[model samples]
Target: MSKEIRNDSECSKTDDKDWHQVTSIEQIEAAIKKEFSDESDSRKTVTAEVKNDKANWKIVLKKKNEKAEENFASEAKSLKDKIYHSRFMTTIRAQKAERFLAGAAVVLVLVVALVSVSVSTCYEVLVDGENVCYISSASELDAALKDLKAQADANTNADMTEAVLSTDVEVAAKHKVFVETASESELAEILQEKVSWQVPGAKIVVNNGESVLAFATLTDAQSVLDTLTQNAIAANSGAKVLDTRFYEDVTAEEGNVDAEDILTPEQALAQIAEGKEEVKTHTVVSGESLWSIASDNGTSVSTLNELNPGLREDRIQIGQEIKLNKIEPLINVVVDKVVTVSEAIPYGETVKESSKLMKGETQVVTKGVEGSKDVTYQISEYNGTTLEKVTLSEVVTKEPVNKVVNKGTATVATSSRSSSGSSSGVFSWPSKGTISSPYGKRGRGFHTGIDIANKKGTPVSAAAGGKVTSAGWSGGYGYCIIVDHGNGMKTRYAHLSKILVSVGDSVSRGEKIGEVGSTGNSTGPHLHFEVIVNGSTKNPINYLK
Candidate 1:
């Protein structure tokens, strides 16, 4: 026992619910042990209540001694061991499953990564800054672009067309994920940028059916044609173009890159004019000239002239031959035009008679000469050949000279003149020189008689004994004389300066009739003689005997 404790309320009044008094220390220790008997509880505590409204409430526990700590640690270790032992097989199976799941997840991750890398490796094709298609191999993309370029080049051969064309294609590898491999055909379709132009265009023609050039559009072709025609017109006044044509032709190809071949207008025109050329021989007809022969043989007159330098326009004879080179163009550049030209005007003559001269004898007192005048003519021509001509105006540049003829009135003695038809069928040479110009074609016109060269005052002789019919000035053959013999025999002497016979006068054989001289249309002094029978002229050599 310790000591007794009393509350203030106890001194005032006693109550039946009073607290029990603590008697000894042994009792307190026993009570404490009983309260803390359970060892599983971590806390070992003791509680006390004090009386009335001012009761002291408190809870306290003793600190664990050495043995107590050891016991607690032992109990924890034992519980851990029991739990582990109870689920030993389950724990082992769970650990095995976890390992397997982790390994499978790592393998799946690796597979996914590999697939991603493979899908990312791809090729991209671009055309003119636009993404065209995707491919698997970089080589494939490059090959496709190359193939397109090759096709384009093949389509555009340099000679076939003019315009040069190309395609802009690019290829590159793109790193991507889950990209599908593109189909070859699909990729080609996507990559194709079909561009079209005149690669193999139609030809333009200039001369008749002659190819002139090639162009892309109809408009371009027409433009070339018009330009050529206009330029020719500008260079040559009144120029006419013949047989021009323009056409189109298409050579389209189904490919990525396309090219065209076009030609220049000049080249095409040259091609159309190709033809064969050769030399040929021709015989002159009765009326054929150099110009006509050239036109027939498709050659120029200059070429014919070169081949036959001796052929003359005015002196061409019958049955003459010539050589020429013939060149025929496939396309005939036949042009036509209208033009104006100038020509000469021949002068006229007037005859005046004088009574002082003899009746049959006539002399040219005044010599007549030609004059000049400008005659303007409107002419239509084809290829320089005159087709039509009309006189527009005529202007005289020089005046004409009029010829005057005098007739002598002197008469010969009757005894001197022999009887008409004195020697029958007898003839003599009319002039002294040999025959210079033969009958038929001579100068500008036909020569009706033979010409004999002699001096100016040479004696003229009669071909036969006959009576003089008449003697006077004659056209072309000035101062002409005609004689009539027995039956139908006659003789004529022309281009005489003096006449010895008159009308109704009889002349003997070998009698002089006139003197030779250059008269109207005569180039020089000569004698023109002819023999006639029954009003028909004959060669003088056959009659002279």
Candidate 2:
């Protein structure tokens, strides 16, 4: 029988099924071929055909029960189980790796924090086996120590010939966490305060008791004493030194001393010479005299003069520095010596009576000549001052000649009237004028003469008959003339406008020798007159007639 069948796109029962029905075997084969066209499909299928009367046919589909399908399903199920197991294992491993990385990060952060808080490398300085300070590095500590030593060497008060620290210093590296560190400058300051220096030195002890000076060495101290002795000896060069010694009981002790106390040779000598007493001085002010200065300071003018040698009482001006105290050396060097010196012997004079001349007139018969002699003296000097001098012997090398003079015994008539109507005494008035300034304490100094005021060109006469000894420009006396009378008496006429007499010219009493005028230290037209007796100044008014 022939059957006719058709495939439906959608049928109520076949639409929900995966199989389709066909009419012929070729059609059924085509349907099977079409359904299994994809070779990758593992689905198994079973086909069945149903025929009814009047040529009606239909194919039905059913699941095939094949071993291959069963094996495939079993294999697929096993493979799916394996895949799920692999995924689960991978997920677990990833989670474990993430957890380990997180733990590692935490450990790394902990390590970094520990490293930040750990002790850092530094240097520790020790002085005399005791810790002094901490610094940043060893090199820095070394530099600081060197700088401290340099500072000690540069100190002027210390003799640093072989400078060394009093205390032992050391540096070491150390790890410190929470400690204070010092900078280079601070470290140097710390070392300076903690350290001291010592040097080989000598102490000069006075009177074998107290130390007076300190030197770098014993040789230096001895040299100072030697120099002082040499200086004292040099002042008296030609003398033969008999003995030399120190007045003070001085001794030098050699030992180690503080560096600051040590001094150079020069410094030690100055200290010994300056002594222990503080020198005092006074500055002269306006209207102040040496007497007033001495009285106010509780001292004598003679003491001031002795303290300050070459100090003139009248020459002291404003702002002159006058020493009130004397400078006495701590040590006095006593030097004893013998000296021989040549001296001049003065000649003597003899008078012979004569009746042929006037009573005041005299004539020289023979000129006197000076003689020389060698004198030996024993001199004891203390610090350049001669403390004692004794003449041992004197030998005359030449005898002096005696001067013979004839004295006049005849009397002659003369005028006894002066310009002032006074008696013509031994000395007459030198000039015709009014006395202005007297021969006494005129101001701050002695005048030594009398000032006579008159008009210019007034005649200045010799006080007595004598020979002109000096006639020239004299200091402060101007164009002056001096006449030497007999019997060690002389007269001076100064501040002259003109000098008529020359040296070695003879003049009588009331003879014009010069003209009076203002010259040199004079204020106006005047004649400054003076009388000198045996090289000593006498008041002009006392001798003037």
Identify the candidate with maximal lDDT. 2
* Model 1, span 1-545: residue lDDT tens: 11212211223221111112222223333333332232233321122211111121112222233434444454434322332232322343445543433322111010011121122367777666677667889788656555655555565433323433354666677754334567876665555544333344445443433323445445545554565445434443643333222222312222221234453455544543344355468888987887888899888888877778876888777677777754444333223333333455455555555544333445667787767777655544332345556676778877777666664443322221235733232356787886779867766887667899988889898765567888989897799899876566667888899988899887755678889888767888899987676777765554454
Stretches of candidate 1 above 4 Å error? 1-198, 206-340, 353-362, 402-414, 417-545
TM-score of each: 0.31, 0.44
What lDDT score is found at residue 3 in candidate 1? Answer: 21
Could you give candidate 2's per-residue lDDT for residues 1-545 as a string of tens digits? 22212222232321112232333334433333343333233333333222221221222232343534554454334322332233322353455543433322111000000012233466889999999888877888768767766776787466676777788888888754334689777887888788878777787788976556767778887888889888878877898989888878988788766777777778877877787788999999999999999999999999999888999987999998999986778888888999999999999999999865434557789999999999999988786577899999999999999999987664322333457856535677888879899889967899988898999999998777778889999988989998877667778888899999899998766778889988888789999888887788787665655
- Which prediction has the highest TM-score against the true structure? 2
lDDT of 1 at 458: 90
Q: What is the lDDT of residue 113 in candidate 2?
A: 6
Which segments of candidate 2 are over 4 A away from where they belong?
A: 1-150, 153-196, 208-211, 230-235, 270-281, 294-314, 323-330, 349-369, 402-545
